[model samples]
Target: MENKVNRNIPDEILASYDYQPFTSTDIEGMPVERVLPTFKATTGSNKLVDSLADLVNKTVRDGMTISFHHHFREGDYVFNKVMRIIIDNGYQNLTLAPSSLTNVMNDIVVEAIEKGVVTNITSSGMRGTLGDAVSHGALANPVIFRSHGNRARAIETGAIKIDVAFLGVPNADEMGNANGMDGDSAFGSLGYALMDAQYAQTVVLITDTLKPYPNTPASIKQTQVDYVVKVDAVGDPEKIGSGATRFTKDPKELKIAEMVNNVITHSPYFKDGFSFQTGTGGAALAVTRFLRQAMLDNQIKASFALGGITKPTVDLLEEGLIGRLMDVQDFDKGAAESMHKNRNQQEIDASWYADAANKGAMVDKLDVVILSALEIDTKFNVNVMSGSDGVIRGAIGGHQDAATAKLTIISAPLVRGRIATVVRDVTTVVTPGESIDVLVTEVGIAINPLRQDLLAALSNVPGVPVFTIDELQQMAEKKVGTPKPLEFTDRVVALIEYRDGTIMDVIREVKD
Candidate 1:
């Protein structure tokens, strides 16, 4: 049945998850409840364990839900090490929940799924071989993909209760107090892992570097922990940002980014002390470079920058352009290193970053946010989850959460080979059009009609050509010649949730 948003979600699918359709975007000051875990009182001295196998034996069981954080990204070692132990010990029917899965985790995840060790899965996103396996129906249960904020919300609401969480930090103490900012393999904030630590029945801290009894400035405190295990190495810090957050020199991307700067500089929100967030992509990085010159020329300084911190954003902070850098996850070594030296570069957890239930999130104060889209429609709906072929290739991440910004701009090329970025309807609606304020493409810019003030603000502004979203779609179709519609089966592969925990869209299995 199609709900108020005119998005067709199957009735059975809706009933399975007990989800309601997205109706409106008015979610201001909504009170949120939390799910607290009950821990058995233990006045024991040291929580140190022997090995990964020992920790697995102590905490994990058959048919239980276990989690890990992806702060280490492709460099993470804890997931594979723990899963190997679980598989070796003959654990079956367990759920593998993580902040997100990277390409490096594909083989282990596939092997675990094939061996019946992991029967269920949930995360922000999955990619590479694991995504291909899931799309081809590898597991008995469908994967549940949520945005970072929604994942935090689900963990807090007890919708997805965790039995054990194997969190790896750069530094931790004997009692399991840990943070991601110190030691050799530092990956910055333990934002995504904080929810797991607070809620998981059993919390295990695996670290390469172990400090003394008390690890001060602990992001994951000793109170929330149950055991600590030492490891030779947690991850490779250099590969923490593989396949994402790279500088781009492509002419098309540069052009799109140049237009994005024009939209921001001409908009009403681009002034002194303005706050903003930019997504990770070649185009977004290029926008930072262009926007830096604009800020220098206009003599405007931003109040702060939010979300996943990158080197370019950190460079702005070091240059005294942005006052503060609220980091939830570090994208590169520069970002991780900056957190160690700079006081203004603060580390924040996922809840404080974008959790809808929190008193206030950093995204709420955002004046402008530039995001990338896999596909966007005339309604201004965005899809960062799947591709034109209906395969899950991306994560919701903080796309929906950051769309609450005053000026939300999606920067993308008009066409990628034969794929049209702008279309009549997106493959999936990850972020609703109601919250989106602008769509910035290489050819032109489309301002949401609801924001008449923005349209008027940039209407006569030089170098910014404002057009209707429909016109942008038509322009894309003309370039791509209206590519054939993707084929999909009725089998639901994944469920896309809005930031408020409602079912906005569902991904069907791709046709064989």
Candidate 2:
């Protein structure tokens, strides 16, 4: 059943589209201002609901789309509480559009699907049992997986309109001014939820701590909100960073980090006013340590550091090594605290961070960005969405968006125990080969041939060895041997869309 004709098109062509200016109008040609009535009241005197059942009965209805944010990471409780209420109320044809679905959300979502309470889902990613269930045709319709930027664009352009946004804030005022900075459940940078506050037809601020009116430095402005509901507790703050941020104690990971720092220092963009973004993993965090010492030696200071804010990145800002910290999300408690105190630590929504349709975003200003990869191909294409077994286990979060930087550096070990990081091709191409500028492993650095300027610039750098990407791939294969081919079902579990909304790749679920 293999097709003969070539349907694959060039990425540039796929990304090219006429830039049409947007007006304030809905899809049906009515003025958006008229369609969505603005709330004029300064405050609502409705008594706070005691339970989720009461909240759902007051806000949720049949065939409506509700949304939640994933700032609490693995410790999120609001999503489950809200979904259970909707299920108990017998609501059907509901679309669950959370920012992302973690392992904890899988069980309840499956039950909701079984009860016919939930049918459609759109999110940045899904993992664990929920992904497995969806892949097995658990629902009649396919799930739509979008990038963080694309989701923001979808909401603003009226493609995926939200009926209600149930925001879980750490601190809020009785008048609906809220932020993720001040209470027991504090999680910094209410970046993702800021978009929901602006676009959702109705926004309910659900918080564990409710302060008095006139909450200053409001992350969620009171003008955009319609209601405020207080709860017993939103989430456990200790679990906010959970698995997202960690310092590596593994020797192998440290070796990879050292190699990554060597690659960065030897690159052309290592001079003053350079910009970069790093992940919150063990090895990735170690890279920052190396980079910090290198910067001190070379007398270089970065203009700004961008992405999900980690405590290490925030430390750079505090130490005057980086001029600004442009944060779209916070990864740890230290970062969450810094956002509250530092005036230079600016909080921005996802659209301003990476949306391609926007006039200009922070990604466009990046000089270099250090990223992680689940699997990389000889072609330099990356797979951050699927695992070696073809299962949906990872997220697309800012990976492709930051790949558009002037220098995109991916730091990963060549192999992890038995699995090779460098394969013939990736399972899912979240980032195309053209966008990746350099690949660094523990053994050596590989400069993309397309980036001849970088290869020429780093030719004589001391203490660094450069090699062809193919040579590194061969070395890894020689050590670990080629991995067995993964078996996948024919059904498409998720569609990977580029920032421009084109189908970059499609991932099929792994066979059980």
Candidate 3:
């Protein structure tokens, strides 16, 4: 079946999952029927478990769905620790439903798949060896890739019912109250884990640092928790943002960042009190740096900033350049530490951050958003999922959710090492072009024809070169030549879901 994005999703696959193909991008938010979670009744003060091995034995069952969070990013240790116990305990056919999978989990997840411990899997995205394994059909079922927002929506609507949620906290009490903003392994807000804590059938809180009985200001409350377990360490804080999202010194990246700032300032959305979201990466983080100066020079202040919190963004919040930081996940240690002292840095759960079913999602209120893409087509559709070689190497993240902003700018280079970043068509469409507004590359910028108002507005901005999407594609092809078409078998490996809970595209297994 061909979706609205024109991607052919196999009918058999759709029937297996009972999911609808991408119909329209204009789907509106409706009142959601929240799925009631099954909870075991227990009245006791002794909710603490001595070890993960004991916890897994008590909570995990064969063919059950289990979940975890990626707040610790690449530094996460809880996942491997829990999975080892489950595999050793001889569990099989369990569904792995984490908020997202980080590379640190690659080896174990692959092993689990091979051993039939995790026969089913779903998450926001995957990369490295795990991605390679999934692409080659390592798991029994095709992996379901949902955006963060969609993951929250799936949980809320019971599309993904988790039997156990193994949440790793930085600080937790014996009674199960916990928070991720304290202790040595603190990685930031417990945004991704909140939904699981509330909706999972059994919520087990794991931590290295056990706080006092009450543990006030708990991000994961005692009422939501079923058990608590103390470990040696939850994760290493330093690698939380892949060793902190640092400032870029690359000249090409900086130039692209400057162009992105120019687009924001010249556009109608850049004003005294506008809201915006920006992704991570050398160029994307640099936009925050460039936007900071623009905000200072124009005497403009952003009303609020959204998405993964970064240190540069925290600097803006502390310096009063931005009024509030609505953080779902913190990207760096500085951002995580700032939340401890700054009241303005509010912690938000995944659903509240970007759930499509939530009418008042933070993403819908954005005036502008700066995003990154692996490749963008002439139609402006963005592919942040699979790379040029038809291998999964990236995540969808907020690319689709954040595209709902008034002006969504995609900042990417024209070519990356003889591979054109701009193509006639993306290898896969993660975010449809209709939602995109502008494409900012180092060589030039291209406004989506759908956004003619922006084109009229930015056409004459001095030093900001304007070009058609076709021209940018031409320049890319001129530099790198046309890329070879990827060959794939009919077997679907993964489903690229839109934030609205519809199938946007399906990735087939690459032919050997």
Which pairs in model 1 have colliding backbones?
A: none
lDDT digits (tens) for residues 237-346 of candidate 2: 77877534567788877987887787788777899999999988788899998899999999999999998988888888999999999989988888988887888899
Best by lDDT: 3
Local distance difference test values of all predictions, in order: 0.87, 0.79, 0.90
Q: List residue ranges in candidate 2 displaced over 4 A.
A: 1-51, 243-247
Between 2 and 3, whose lDDT is larger? Answer: 3
Model 3 local distance difference test score = 0.90
Weakest lDDT window of 10 consecutive positions for candidate 3:
237-246
Number of clashes in model 1? 0
**Candidate 2 weakest ten by summed lDDT:** 18-27
TM-score of each: 0.97, 0.90, 0.98
Cα RMSD, each candidate = 1.6, 5.2, 1.2
Off by over 4 Å in 3: 29-31, 242-245
Per-residue lDDT, model 1, residue 436, is 89
Residue 107 miss distance in model 3 (angstroms): 0.3
Off by over 4 Å in 1: 29-31, 242-247
Candidate 1 lDDT over 1-512, as tens digits, reads: 88655778888878888888877767776667888888897778898887778778878889999999999998988888998899899899998889899888999999999999999898888877888888888877888888898888889988889999999989999898898889888888788899899999999999989898788778899999999899999998778764345668898888889989989998888999999999778999999999999999999999999999898999999899999999899888788877878999988888889988778888888899999899889999998888777778888899999998889999988788889999999998889999888888877899889999988888886667889999999998988796778888888888878888888888888887
